[model samples]
Target: MKDRFVANQNAHLEMVLQQMTERLLQATSRLMARQGRPPQCNYEKKQNVWSLATSRRHCVE
Candidate 1:
């Protein structure tokens, strides 16, 4: 049935989104570890959603 098909498709998409989130978390942790300190991160609110970004700070050694 069309309803069942749509439900299955939505479930598949949800699983993919969860997997992507996990990967992003792992990558961010690695970046933080290599930087030796927490990277400067920024947050912005767009509509009902929030966005985050991280970057290394440049400092003279």
Candidate 2:
């Protein structure tokens, strides 16, 4: 009986973990989409400003 209970608990934990992982992936995708692809610029001023704007837009979205 104890072993069975442990197994059940483990299964429940696994399900919770899976759900958490799915949510995390979804959040990551949304973030990436909002941020768009990485900047192509190599200069500091453009890259910094662009990245800041992307982050701000993501927050608004």
Candidate 3:
């Protein structure tokens, strides 16, 4: 049970980090757009970004 908890916590941390990275990337992209520069992500254009990596935009994906 202790090991399982540790594993679960690690997974949650990784997921959180991934979500933050995606948000930063998108925000950086948008900032660059306003500065007359292009984004480096090259993510496929979607009607909305509610799905940066997973299909949810909540703080944790």
Candidate 4:
């Protein structure tokens, strides 16, 4: 029963994480759209996991 409970909790956590990721991406897209520029993405490796970092470049034009 304990293993079942743990499995259920893990599933819930994964679902919540996925939802958060989707929301973040949506917000980022909207922000870029409003700014009228695409974000520059950088990938950094940390603890064997790759994560994305984004920055908006100041347009000189």
Off by more than 4 A, model 1: 38-61
Alpha-carbon TM-score of each model against the true structure: 0.59, 0.60, 0.65, 0.61
lDDT of 2 by residue, 1-61 (tens): 9998986896687568656755665566566668985434334454466557656855775
- Model 2: per-residue Cα lDDT at residue 43: 43
- Clashes within 3 Å, all models in order: 0, 0, 0, 0
lDDT of candidate 1? Answer: 0.52
What local distance difference test score does each model get? 0.52, 0.62, 0.67, 0.54
Q: How far out, in Å, is residue 50 in model 1?
A: 15
State the displacement of the C-alpha of residue 44, model 2, in Å, after optimal TM-score superposition: 35
Q: Least accurate stretch of 10 residues (summed lDDT) in model 3?
A: 46-55
Across residues 1-61, which tens digit of lDDT does each residue of candidate 1 receive? Answer: 9998986896687568656765676677678879896634421122113112211111211
Give the runs in model 3 whose Cα sits over 4 Å from its true position. 44-61
lDDT of 4 by residue, 12-56 (tens): 875686567666766776788799977553212221131222111
Residue 44, candidate 2: alpha-carbon lDDT: 49
lDDT of 2 at 7: 68
RMSD of each: 13.8, 14.7, 6.7, 13.3
